[model samples]
Target: MRRAPIIAVVLALAVPSLARADIQPHKAIYDLVDEDGAATGGRVEYEILGNACDGWAVLQKIDIPKAGARVVTTNASWEAADGSAMRFHETTERDGQTVSRFRGQAASGSNGFAVFTDGEGGESFGQLPQGTLLPTLQTKTLLTQAKRDRSVLSSNKVFLGTSSEGALPLEITSVLSPRASTPGDHPELDGQPSWNVTSSFYEAGGRPDTGPDYTVRSIQFGNGVVQSMEITREGATARARLRSLDLYEVVECNR
Candidate 1:
């Protein structure tokens, strides 16, 4: 079984709330750690912009400093407000040298169909399965289930281009429950209603009974902010702790 890097998990995680009410636009910073709970001398900077009218904009940066090398990935993405389309560009750098770059887009037809294509050849890479969703819609679906007191969160498929080899569809299942009280460096999130979300990922078309390729545990706030998260794959764990947060007020888009 193969899995994405720990930091890449943060890239695929979505933070924005639903439309109209409680739409959160914010910046979150986190400190990285390894399986033994030791600091990794790296950090993650995740930002969300745009609103329901213009869709969601995301920019994520991961920087990890090793003994003699460094790995960094900077990704920028946007999803349509109608949950019908998305576009993304990503770059990965190692030791101050860029090693990889790719850009792609996904769109649904008027008949409720979509495809995700990559590379500069302008060809259809693959036809995504029905009910596939990008970040904003993905979060909305989970939050909706959470509000309805559903513990077993389900998603048909998710396309995040999270794979190092290339973009791939992934099947996600999560359990949502009330979060226990936890302290954080940010006061605004203190005592806020939160949920303990644990998600498991399987290959898009694989049988879930065979077991998940990886798992992620996170504390998600009502305002669509994440307090902390851990990724465990094959017993190797990586964690991210909230270091700082800056929340932005949702604004109206005047036509």
Candidate 2:
């Protein structure tokens, strides 16, 4: 699917976060592999938005394949709210794809974060049941809890319509912190990847909620182009080979 034009404009806005963290240059294609060294066949498209000085950030488009004719697609926007702040918004498309099955918004504040969404496609991450009280409580209650402790953890869970079999859930997790840095591979970046990044959800604990490990490493390419990366997932018992990368200019948006 083609990226929305609105994203094009957002991509061009330069901000401080983009420059502070030695993030890679914008616009690239990345592949997601499973533990067996086989491509999970999941594809991620990313682009840096704006100039590095403004508040550089990355936007990702994810497409997941299903068993038969069904395909799950998510358009995610990750913005560096400054050197220390980041926020995310995701819209999901499933089955036919024309109609929006689910839509959600999540933002992080100094203390913690909250997510809110109302849609039919609850099966995708972040999308929830209509008027679910716990989510609403999390929005108001969790915020204060985070502020009191100053350490917080939050994630998005999408619950599709229920069937006789049971409820199907999809999840997306994020770790927010005051001192998180960029991935270690890109030390030049102003910000480092958040420390102690762990993602998980309850089962009936199924495989759908688990994600592959990613470790980025810097590798020298014969060409002038430079990049770093690694993939390490305990479940997959696979390691991402040292691969070449291209670091692009990140644009920051003026808030």
Best by lDDT: 1
Sequence-dependent TM-score of model 2? 0.41
Off by over 4 Å in 1: 1-4, 35-38, 109-124, 150-152, 164-167, 253-255
Reference-based TM-score of each model: 0.86, 0.41
Model 2 residue 193 lDDT?
Answer: 28
CA shift of 178, model 1, Å: 1.1
Candidate 1 lDDT, 1-255, residue by residue in tens: 123355666446555547544657889888897766577788999888887788788888999876779988888888887667888777778998887666777765433333334334443366666667766677777776676674645655776655432345678777888766655436878755678888887765567888887888988876788877898787777798888889898877664
lDDT of 2 by residue, 38-114 (tens): 67665555555544344334554555565754444444444333322233444556566644433333333333323
The Cα RMSD of model 1 versus the native structure comes to 3.0
* CA-lDDT, candidates in order: 0.71, 0.34
Candidate 2 residues lying further than 4 Å off, grouped into runs, are 1-21, 34-36, 81-87, 98-113, 120-247, 250-255
